[model samples]
Target chain A: MVTDKHYAALDQVLELAVLINDDMTRSLAQDGLTVSRTHLLWELRRRGPSTQRDLADALKVSARTVTGLVDGLEATGFVTRQPHPTDRRATLVTFTERGVRTVEEMERGQQEFARLLFAEMPEERLDCFSEALGEILIRLREASRLTDPRGGDQ
Target chain B: MVTDKHYAALDQVLELAVLINDDMTRSLAQDGLTVSRTHLLWELRRRGPSTQRDLADALKVSARTVTGLVDGLEATGFVTRQPHPTDRRATLVTFTERGVRTVEEMERGQQEFARLLFAEMPEERLDCFSEALGEILIRLREASRLTDPRGGDQ
Candidate 1:
């Protein structure tokens, strides 16, 4: 049975997630960007230049959806498509200079947010909180894996 | 300065949110529902019944979007529209029997998930973890409010 405290904690986490998402949406909208487009940009930042096919597989989205997202990002000047270095039949998506700077700013903003949350927190309490979060993440991942249909054979 | 521990905790929270969302999406797919549809159902369950205008206001979505979601839910037999008792121009969206049962199941599942996460935890540690979450939630909300354009006048 879940205690009232457990329920409270769970509610807090969910509310925080929703609030974080709303904040992100609003922030991204200022740049005329959507979450899906930012996600594509992030993938490019992490993977360097990538083909649309690879991006589709990485995002678990269809080729058409990836194409649409790439088109939107390219139009927004965040990414550009070029002929693959070797594969004549394929095009690679890469971040523009502005895109790199924007991604770096996003990373800096995330770090600043974390600092705002934890700057005044006691070191010991922060440790405890981190451990609790780490443990919960492990358990949640295991639970999700168990329920995931694609993992049914595992 | 934010420590590596802070970054790890934030990442864990974000990853947990994404995983939770993925799990919910998969579960709702089994019921032919999307997150927006479920949000409507949840609002109905909490508010008893609501008009499309009211739902749009509560959800911060457009009236047309709410209508589309309600139409989909009605087609699935999860909800139905009834004429308002006094307001001739208004119709209230109410859940069907199946809808009520499904909402109850969703609520119970949430409690079960909380229990699974905290059942084995020590009471003292749980208290500490809850306190940490409560504190962070307070800070996050304030931060979001400060950044919210709608709250600028405040």
Candidate 2:
């Protein structure tokens, strides 16, 4: 039975994500970078630059997420998004001079944030939750993806 | 440590939420309702209408969430927000005639969705996960809510 408590818990997850992003954006402002900015810069450098789609896949994030990151990075002069000449559907994401220099710093900051986020989590449970979450995501993806708006693959 | 798998899982949670919302919105469209609209109408019916802030608190939802709900409901002539003369900042939300008739249908749809969402879950594990999620939400709320951007309760 999915009780009202379950509903509350689900709502909490949504709020928690927003809160986490807000806090990260605020804290990163001191260094002139947001969480999205840092991650995108670091990923671009690590992957030797890539298309937005490839970057999304490599980072295991959504295309919309990558777009948001690129938006922030571009606004901050940390990245440039260029239309890929060979692929009309693709956007090339490459580091700016500033981004190249800051990528290492961003990588370090990313690690620090990750450490802080999981500092109190029990490793065993975190691993279990991660695994469980993976399964749920797969099921959800199957239910919602593969089937297009017309109810079939695009 | 937040490894690649952990990050992947986190991204999955986000995408899953999006997918769940998309599915719900589609399901609700048949009756000229969105998920937030349906939930808000049902809540108002069950809780006997109340101040927006009080309703948000009781539902463990954000003010923004309530605002979105009220936006849809008000647009559809299912609810109204009236200024409280005594409390200058408060807006009381009350169901309209359409809302009263729709509430029962919304409740049924909500239950059907809940059953489908949790059909495969073990009750014991679901309960455990719900508890864990509740704790995470409290920590997130504490970290983010105390320091407001405009530095006001609003």
Candidate 3:
């Protein structure tokens, strides 16, 4: 049985995660972007141009949601959809120069935010924290897969 | 300098966090509730009734957002807003019986989801993962305080 202390700890993690995401979203919003949009841009920057379905899969969002996000980004002149190199039915979504700059700015902000957050922690503790987070993340990912068999199979 | 491996691990943590939140949101939506709304109900159920500003602080959302959410909850007969006992300018929000049931259902879903997610992991590894998550959570909370001085101060 899960104890109250365990529940409290889980609640703290959930609350902190929400707050961190909110701050990141607000920071990105100041640059005329939402976290979702920033994430798409970041993925493109990291993995090069990808089709809409590929992005939807990677982001774990529905294809319709991805289409709407792409439409918004395109309207903002941050991305353009070009014909896929080999698939006639597929379209490759590439970032514009503006998108690149925006993503870089967002990345810089995130890194700075992270650095400031960790500035007070001892280096060893920071290392521990990072490692611990990594382990939990792996567990959570594996767990999420089991709960969503469709997600796991994909 | 952060090693490439460490950086990769951090990226995995970040991605997994997003995915988990998405999964939770979808799960909550299936029960005719959004995570944000259910969060308020859970808070009230755990901590008793609270003012809008207090709820906002606890949820790390803006007061305006909380106001809208409360409005919707009140309309759905899941919550009630009453005058604050001591603060004339504030209104206390509490969960109704329906609200409590809703929160309980959401919690059950979440716990089951977590159980499914970790079923495959060795118990020892699960404990380690939980401990690591707890440590990182503590550090993240401390770090967030430094970056946002106004957070939790109100």
Task: Identify the leading candidate in terms of lDDT.
Answer: 1
lDDT of 1 by residue, B1-154 (tens): 7788889878876776687777667777757789899989989888988999999888878899999999999999899999999999999999999999989998987888888777777877777788888888778888888888767223
Model 2, residue B19: C-alpha shift (Å) = 4.2
For B26-83, candidate 2 gives per-residue lDDT tens digits of: 6678555776567677678878868988878766678888888888788888888888
Q: What ordering of candidates by DockQ runs from best to worst?
A: 1, 2, 3
Residue-wise lDDT of candidate 3 within B89-138, one digit each (tens)?
99989888888887788788766655544545455555555665555566
Clashes of each: 0, 0, 1
Ranking the candidates on lDDT from highest down gives 1, 3, 2
Label model 2 with its docking quality class: acceptable
Residue A106 error for model 1, in Å?
A: 1.0
Runs with alpha carbons beyond 4 Å of true place in candidate 3: A83-90, A105-135, A149-152, B50-64, B81-92, B104-139, B142-152
The chain B TM-scores of all candidates, as shown, are 0.89, 0.60, 0.80
- Give a tens-digit lDDT track for model 2, residues A1-154: 6677555545554455556656656656744676556666667777876898888877657889988888878887888988897989888988888877777675565565554445466766666565555655666566666533655333
Write out the backbone clash pairs for model 3.
A143-B117
Report the number of the highest-DockQ candidate: 1
Go through the candidates in order and give each one's C-alpha lDDT.
Answer: 0.83, 0.67, 0.72
Q: Candidate 3, residues A1-154: lDDT per residue as tens digits?
A: 5445445546655665676675666567654578788888887887899999999998878999999999999999899999998999999999889888888887777666555444445565546556655655666766667667466646
Provide TM-scores for the models.
0.92, 0.61, 0.72
The predictions' CA RMSDs to the true structure, in order, are: 2.3, 5.9, 4.5
Model 1 chain B worst lDDT window (10 residues): B145-154
